[model samples]
Target: MYIEYIAMELPRKLIGSLSQFWKINVLDIKQLYDSVEKLVFVSISLEKRKTDVVRSRYNSTMRVPKALNPRLQKQLLLRFGVYETVYPVETTPSRTVPDHIEKPEYVLQKQPTVLPDKAEVKDVNQLRGMRRSCKLAANILAHVQKNIYPGITTDDIDGMVHKLTVEAGAYPSPLHYKGFPKSVCTSVNNVAVHGIPDLRPLRDGDIINVDITVSLITVITLCWHQYVNSLQNNAIKTCGPEVPFSEIGASIFRHSKRNGLTVLPAFIGHGIGRYFHGPPDIYHTLNRYRGRMRPGMTFTIEPVLSHGSKHTLILPDGWTVVTEDGARSAQAEHTVLVTEDGAEILTK
Candidate 1:
C-alpha cells in the first residue's frame, strides 16, 4: 500500500497555478482587504459561464459571494457532476485578556496568522500553562467520553462540556468564535469534524472524538485570546476552524488517485496559542509544509482519512464539514508539547 515499506524517495509534481485547475472558467475579486484589514474574498462561481451544466444551482443570492479566510489558496472543485460551491470565510474581533497575566510573546498589533516553527518546545511558564490546560481539556474529554454509548445525543455531550468548562472557571474555547455554537466538537464516524453537536444519538461502535479546549485564564491570554489545548491520542482528531488547508491534502489526493480511495483536502492541524489558529500548520498528507516539532512550541496535526471518495460539502450551517459521497471516516488528535528530546502528548 502506497509504496509503503519501500525504501525510497520518488519524483513528484505540485500544481502551482489556480488557473490550470479544470472546469474553472472565472475567479474574480468582489472585494479586497486593505493593509489594515486581513484579505477576505467574496467567493464566486465560474461554473455556469463555462457550461449550462452549472447555470441551475443558484438562488442568485448564492452568487452574491461570501468572504473566505486568506489562508485558503484555491478551493473551487467539480461537484455532484453538476453543483458547485466556494467555501465560506470569517474573521474574529480581537480577544481581550486580563492585564495581570503574562501573555505569550507573539501577540502583535495585527494578529499574526502565520504559524511558528515545528515541534516547538515550550518554556517553563508556557509549558506549565499548556500542561494545566491540556489536563483540563483531557479531563473534560474524559468526562464527556462516558456519554458515547448508544442513544445519547451529540448535543448532550456538548452540554456536558460547556457546563463543566464554566464550572472549572474556563471559557468554552469554540463558542462564538467564528460563529461556532458548540463548545466541544463531537465528530461521529464518517463525519471528519465540525460536526455541530445536534440531537443525533450515538449507535454501537460509533467511534467519536470529544475534543475539548478550555481557555485557561487567571492572569494572561496567549496571543490575546483564550489559550487552549486538546485531548486524545497522538493521531489526527481535530477542532475545526483551527485547521484550514491541510498539508496532507496533497498526499491524500495522490494516494487516493492511485488507490481509488477518496481523500478530503480541506483541513489540517495548526498551532493554537493566544489566537485560536495560527501557523506551523501540521499536515497529515505529504507536502512541503516546513513546520517542524521542537521544544516550547504547540500545535495540532489532525488528518481526516476516508474509506470512499474524498469529495466534501459545507453544511447549511456554513461551518460543519462532511463527505459529499457518503464515505465513513475516522480521526484522532492531541495537543503536542515538544520536549528536549521528543514529543509529549499533553492530552494523555
Candidate 2:
C-alpha cells in the first residue's frame, strides 16, 4: 500500500510547474474595471507524449507551488507522489506567457458531452449486480469524504481513495479518461464541476464535493453534451445572449458548456448497469436529459453543487477547475439500480 501510494503522486510534478514561473496578483487594467487576464496552468500530463510507462521522475527535494488558498497549498505538499505533484507558479508583470500556444483557436471551452443511449438491461438480477458495484463505489467515496477534512490536500484524498478502490478490486475511473490526471473530482468553491483532485486541502469554511463514478472502460463517456445545450437553451430564455457578461454569466456558461466540466447541480445522478451511463439522465437543474430508468440500468448521480454565482477558474493545467467567486461548494454522489418499485443507492 505504501509503495502504491508513492506511485500515484507522480502526476503532480507536472502540474506544479505553473507556480514556479508566475506570481499570482490581483491587478487592475488602466481603462476597464477588470484587470489583465490572469493566466494559471492547472494541468500537466507526462503521458501526453507517452502513455504506456510513467515517463518523468523527480528527486525527493521538490517544491510545490503555493495555492492561492493557503490551506490548500499546505495540503498539496503532503500529497506528492511518483505519478504527480502540485506545482505553483506565481505570475507577475516580469513573467512572460508561453508562446507555444500561438493561435487564438487554442482556447479551451468548458463543456459537457452527450452520452449515447444506455444499453438495454434484461432484468432485475443484472440491475442488482450493478447496484452492488455502485454501492461499493459509493461507500468508498463516503470513506473519502469522511477522511478528507480541512488541512488535507486533494492529492492526499486521491491517494486514500485510490488505495481503497484498488483494495476492493475496483479502479479509479477518472485516472486516465482521455488523459485526465487524477482519480477523483475535487471541486472547491466556484468550481462548478470537473475540478481535479490536487494537494490542496479542505478549509474550515470550504464546501467541496467529490463526484464518484465507477472505473469502467466499457461504459460510455459519462458526461453527455446534450445536457449542456439544454441548459444553454434555458439560459437564452432567462436572459438573451445579448445580455452583458457578468459574474453570473460565468456561472451559467460554465454549466452550459458542451464539455463535461460543468455538471448539472440539481439534476445530477444516474442509473448504472451494463450501460454505465444509463437512461433517465439526471438533470442538474430540473432540465430534461431524456431517457428513462429501466430495470438493470445503472448510473451515477454525482452533482457538482456550488455557492452563489457559477463562474469558474480553469487552472492553466486546463483540468483543475475552480469557482470564479471563490464561494464554497459541496457534492454527494451514488450509483443506483432501478428496481421494480423505485431506486437503490448503490454507493451507500
Candidate 3:
C-alpha cells in the first residue's frame, strides 16, 4: 500500500528534444519542478524464459535448478548470460562548484535539507529564472550525450557535468544536497533511480539514465536514458489548468500496461523550483493525492517503467535503488508550467 502525503501547490511546465537515434513516445501525466526537463528513452524486448543448460561464468557447464530461490535464480541468470549486473566501484570525492556561483538555501544549512510544504506560484521574474536554468540543464545533457560510449566510467560523466555546470557559472544542484556525494546520477541497466556515479565503465549494449540538475537563479533538473549502442522512446503531454493531478499517473499506468510494462510506484515526481524537491508528490500510479494544476505553477512528471516485477530495493549506500527481481527499468521526466490556456514545456 502507498502512504499518501499531504498535497501541496507547485509550478508546471514541459521541455523536450528529439534526437536522430531516439524514438519519442508520450505516455501520461505527473508534475515536478526544476529549471531542467528530462526525457527518458526506454527500449524493452521481452523473450521467453530459457530452460536450456548453459555454461556458468566459471567456464563450467551447469543447469540452474528450478527450485532455487528467486534471488539465486537471478544470480544464475546473470552468470548464464541473461544480462550483466551493475555494481558500484570507487567513486572520487565530490566535485566542487565555484564559490562565486549562487548556491541553493539547503547548501548553507547545517543539515542541508529543504522541505517544500506548498506549491509556489512563479512571478514573471521567477519564470524567467526558471527558463534560463532549465535551458542550461538541457544544453548540458546534450553535451554529455556526445561523451557517452563504452569504457567511459560514470564518474567521468560526473566530472564532465561538474566542469560544464561550473564553467557556465551555474552550480550542479545534486552536489552537497542532502549529503549526496555526486554531481549527477547515473543508473545503468537494472539499477533504478538515484544511482550514484562510480568507477564502472559503461559497456556496449548497456542502457543508462543520466539525471542532471543545475542551479542558476533558479534550480532546474532533467533526465535522459540512452542505450550504449541502441535507442529507445520517451515523451511528455500537457493538460489545461485545474485538471486533477491524479489523472496523470492513471493515464501513464494505462499506457504502460498496454505496452506490456509495469510502472514502479515507489518513486513519485515532485514539485521543483528554487528547491530540489517539493510538494504535489506526483504519483506515477493511480492514487488519491489531492491537488489540481493552477496557472503559473511548475512541477515535474517523471515515471519509471519496468520490464519485469516492480519491486525494488535500496543499496547499502542509502541512495542507489535497484530492481528486486533484477529487471531492467526505464524513466522519463519533464518540468512543466500550467498556463491559462494550457501547460508549457519550459525545458523544451
- Judging by lDDT against the true structure, name the best candidate: 3
lDDT of 1: 0.50
List where candidate 1 sits over 4 angstroms from the true fold: 1-121, 218-263
Give per-model TM-scores: 0.58, 0.50, 0.73
Error of 2 at 153 (Å): 1.2
On the 0 to 100 scale, the lDDT of residue 107 in model 1 is 30
By TM-score, the better pick of 2 and 3 is 3
Model 1: per-residue lDDT, tens digit, 11-100?
122111322433344465432323314333444454334223222222232211121332321221121111222222232232333344
lDDT of each: 0.50, 0.44, 0.69
Ranking by lDDT: 3, 1, 2
Residue 337 of model 3 has an lDDT of 80
Q: What are the per-residue Cα lDDT tens digits for candidate 2 across 43-126? A: 333324321111121121233433457686555435421122222222112111233322111112224334445535546565
Residue-level lDDT tens digits of model 3 in 1-348: 111111222122232222221243433223223422443322211231211101111122122322236786676456433446665669999887778888877787645446557777778988888888888888888898888999999999999999999999998888877788999989887788888999988887676888888888756555454431111112235355888888777777777777766789998888888767888788888888888888888888778876666767776677888775566677766677879997886665
Which is better, 1 or 2, measured by TM-score? 1
Task: Report the number of backbone clashes for model 3.
Answer: 33
* Collision count for each candidate, in order: 28, 69, 33
* Predictions: Cα RMSD each: 14.0, 17.0, 16.0
Among all windows of 10 consecutive residues in model 1, the one with the lowest summed lDDT is 1-10
